[model samples]
Target: MTRTEELFLALRQQIVEGKIPHGHKISEPELANQFQVSRSTLRDALARLKSIGLLVSQPNVGYSVISLSTEHLMEIFYVREALEGMACRLAASNITQEQLQNLRDLLESHESSVQLKSGVAYIQEERDLDFHFVIVQASHNPMLIDLLCEKLYFLVRMYRYQFGMVSDRAKRAFFEHQHIVHALSVGDGELAEFLMRRHISASRDNVERNLLVNKGVIS
Candidate 1:
């Protein structure tokens, strides 16, 4: 990767991982020095992140991490439901046996990781994306994947935080994934799509509930 690309990846990972909290100002000069890159290179990396809605740039004040809010969460989940629902439906028709086996393997690995009580930090996120990405690819829908990738950045950032708030939510999500996979394995498009939709809807509801509870808006 180019230096700028490398920097962009690092910064984006840090932001999503919560190493840099929302609304925190990002100092270009400091980052440039830290990464041992020139100001232009740092600016290029920051610009890429800005385009993705992860960072907002001010004329003179520099960039700050974008904050997650209820409105934003709703919008993200709405798009996810439509796009991911379609992906699941298409995957039901197009998924190969090998792909189905891969999905099963991911589920098995996820189950093992959770059984060890390994905190669901990296493994959960990795397996979750793996399962979904497999479905997305099976759909053979390039445009949908492109759009989903854009939205996924912010969704991952926001959901990861809220995910941590929900005890054992990752394991619950894994079980939901298993249901979808089982339906897919049987070539039941309707049931697979239904399960996938319900899974995403539940996640949206949980995220909204957590936000409200955290804000004292719900009992």
Candidate 2:
């Protein structure tokens, strides 16, 4: 990759991985020096990250990591419902035996977590995301995988980390993922799609009810 793309990925990873932290102002001079690039090049990289929703640019404050809101959660889950639902559907037929085994193993791991009663640790959200990500990649659709894995998951991780996950949500998600996996293992595409959509919708509703309070999206 070119220097610009390399810088872009470096900064994007820092933001998504929470190294930079959300809502923290990005210092161009510092970043440029760190990346060993000029300010103009760093600005170009920042612009690309902004376009992908990993960064937000303001008039006077310059750029910072995008902060989470209930509205952003709603929109992110909406996209996930549509894209990941399709991904599960496609994975039903396309998912291989090895992939099915992996899902089963993942389910068992989650069951262990539930048994230990540590579901509120926020680590489950990361593990939960890994499960969804495997299925999304199993869809065998390049564009869909890229959209869900590379872009949406970054925002999803950010929101999950910031808002936190309760035990109730974690338990529900574990069971939901199990059902979706079972459907896919049986080659029931329609059922997998339905279950995935319902799972994501429930998550969205929970966030809206508990965290958002009718704050709609900002343009």
Candidate 3:
């Protein structure tokens, strides 16, 4: 990767992992010096982060990391329910034999990971094999890929990392993934869409329940 691209990814990881805490103001000159990059290069990276909604720059205020909000997280889940559902439906039709095998392999590996973690939610290790991400790519729809994978996925990971979000339904989620994959393998677009939507809905419900009961985020 080029210097600017490298800087962009580095800053993005730090921000998403909360190394640079949410709502922390960024000083361009200081950040540039810290990273040993030029001001222009740093600005390029910051602008890319801003494009993804991770950072916001005001007229006089410069840039600050976006604060985590339960409401926004729920909003994203709703969008994922719709878009990823459609992607799953399209994937049932457009997916290649190789893609199908890749998905099956991914599930096997994910299953092993889940078992190793004692039913804990498996984190995406191979970026390409992130189950949902791979399914979306299988749709062969550039718009859907860009919206979900490029735009929203990182934000979801950010929330998970920052909140230490771990679902009690990890094993159940793995089963749901299996069902969705089966529907895709059989080229059942309707079933695939329904299963995908239901999976995302369940996840959103879990997050809402935890926010209310555990975090008391909702009154």
Per-candidate local distance difference test: 0.75, 0.80, 0.88
Residue lDDT tens for model 1, 1-219: 899999998998888777887778998778888899999999898898887778888787889988766777688888778788888888888888888888888777767774425544424454235677778777667777766666474545545654464444566787789889888888788888888888888888877876777784322
Clash pairs (backbone) in predicted model 2: none
Segments in model 2 whose C-alpha atoms lie over 4 Å from true places: 1-10, 17-21, 34-41, 44-48, 58-62, 114-122, 125-129, 212-219
Query: Candidate 1 regions off by >4 Å?
Result: 115-123, 127-129, 162-165, 168-172, 216-219
Give all TM-scores, in the order shown. 0.83, 0.80, 0.94
Question: Which residue pairs overlap in candidate 3's backbone?
Answer: none
Report the error of model 3 at residue 69, Å: 0.7
What would the per-residue lDDT of candidate 3 be over residues 1-219, giving only the tens digit for each residue?
Answer: 889999999999999899998889999988999999999999999998998888989999999998888898899899999999999999999999999999999988877774436865656653587899999999999999988888787887788787674668788888899999999999999999999999999999988888888775432
RMSD of each: 3.4, 3.9, 1.8
How well does model 2 score by local distance difference test? 0.80
For candidate 1, the C-alpha RMSD (Å) to the true structure equals: 3.4
Residue-pair clash count for candidate 3: 0
TM-score for predicted model 2 compared with the true structure: 0.80
Who wins the TM-score comparison?
Answer: 3
Which candidate number maximizes lDDT?
A: 3
Prediction-by-prediction clash tally = 0, 0, 0
The window of 10 residues in a row where model 1 has the poorest summed lDDT is 119-128
